[model samples]
Target: MSAITLEIDGNKVQVTDGMTVLEAADNAGIFIPTLCHHDKLEPFGGCRLCIVEVEERGWTKMVVSCVYLAAEGLVVRTRSDKVDRIRKTILELLLAHAPDAEVLKELAQEYGADKDRFEKDPSFCIHCGLCVRYCAEVKQKFAVGFVDRGIRKEISFIPEIAARECNACKECFPLCPTSYLQAAFVLTESLAFPAQQKKSE
Candidate 1:
């Protein structure tokens, strides 16, 4: 395969053609923050957290590095004051929407974001679709699908009750970027199976 040379954070790096900016950064030891992207799955470009300033057509524009393929002579800036501020704002917004989301909280803390300017929403789920994608594409189980649209959309198994088409494989739960599914499972198991056994007659 051919190689593409790009400048990332003023560092010259060469990556295989068709590789995304994020992949090139990884190879070059430059860290780029991301939330909706996973190495095991295809880039969905849902979250703008991985946004990077790219020099294109003589203009620098913010682009999601996970989905934007690196090209020869491409200039990519992964870290800059503008990029950092944007990333912090995005993390803050996501945290406000899902305060209890551990993964989101960690990301916010990582970026030193201490305040959430946006109004808080009780409903969780940032709508990254990691769970849905993992189930359908990786696990080959289309048991769960997103219901409703926009703000009301959420992931749930078919029938919503009947034995859960989940197959109890625990695949979707782990792939979820947020802690919602995994936390719920732990709570359910604790309630369903009490550690202390009752005295038998």
Candidate 2:
């Protein structure tokens, strides 16, 4: 892979081809907050918190850093008034689902997002997909996954797979950003969502 040079938060960064803006930022030690991105898993932009303003050829546009490919001569601003505003709004929406999620609260403080900005809909899952992806991609065990779609989407553990695989491989549990999410604080979360724990039946 050829080296691509870009600027992130005014710091010059050199990264290889096919690298995402978020990876470039990480290599340069630029902190771009993200919830849906994990080093061991493929880039998942489920949480738009890593959104950044990319200015290339004088046209500035916002893109999710985790999935946006880094390009030569790209000027990436990880934080700005506009970016902050967008993050605040996204945080507010996510906060509505997991109001007590410590990660959201900390990011909300940085972005001035009111946790109460939106009415609580508290499904308790922010849909970051960390557990789902980690289990499938890293562990090669499809124990936990999302069920339903759109607003009704929620995470569930596969009873049989989770029973056999997850009991010993609970690595994805800590990856959840929603701390104390309902009963997710422990392995018993598998029992909490017995409704959809899939494919294992």
Candidate of highest TM-score: 2
lDDT of 2 at 124: 83
Which segments of candidate 1 are over 4 A away from where they belong?
Answer: 160-167, 183-201
lDDT of 2: 0.85
TM-score for candidate 2: 0.90
What TM-score against the true fold does each predicted structure earn?
Answer: 0.83, 0.90
Which residue window of length 10 is worst by lDDT in model 1? Answer: 192-201
lDDT of 1: 0.76
lDDT of 1 by residue, 1-201 (tens): 898899999999999998999999999999887767887889998778999999966889899999999999999998888888889988888877677677777777877775456788855677787877877788766655678988777665553321343435777676666666555444444454323212111
List pairs with backbone clashes in candidate 2. Answer: none
- Tens-digit lDDT track for model 2 on 34-76? 9999999999899989999999999999999999999999999
Give the worst 10-residue stretch by lDDT in candidate 2. Answer: 180-189
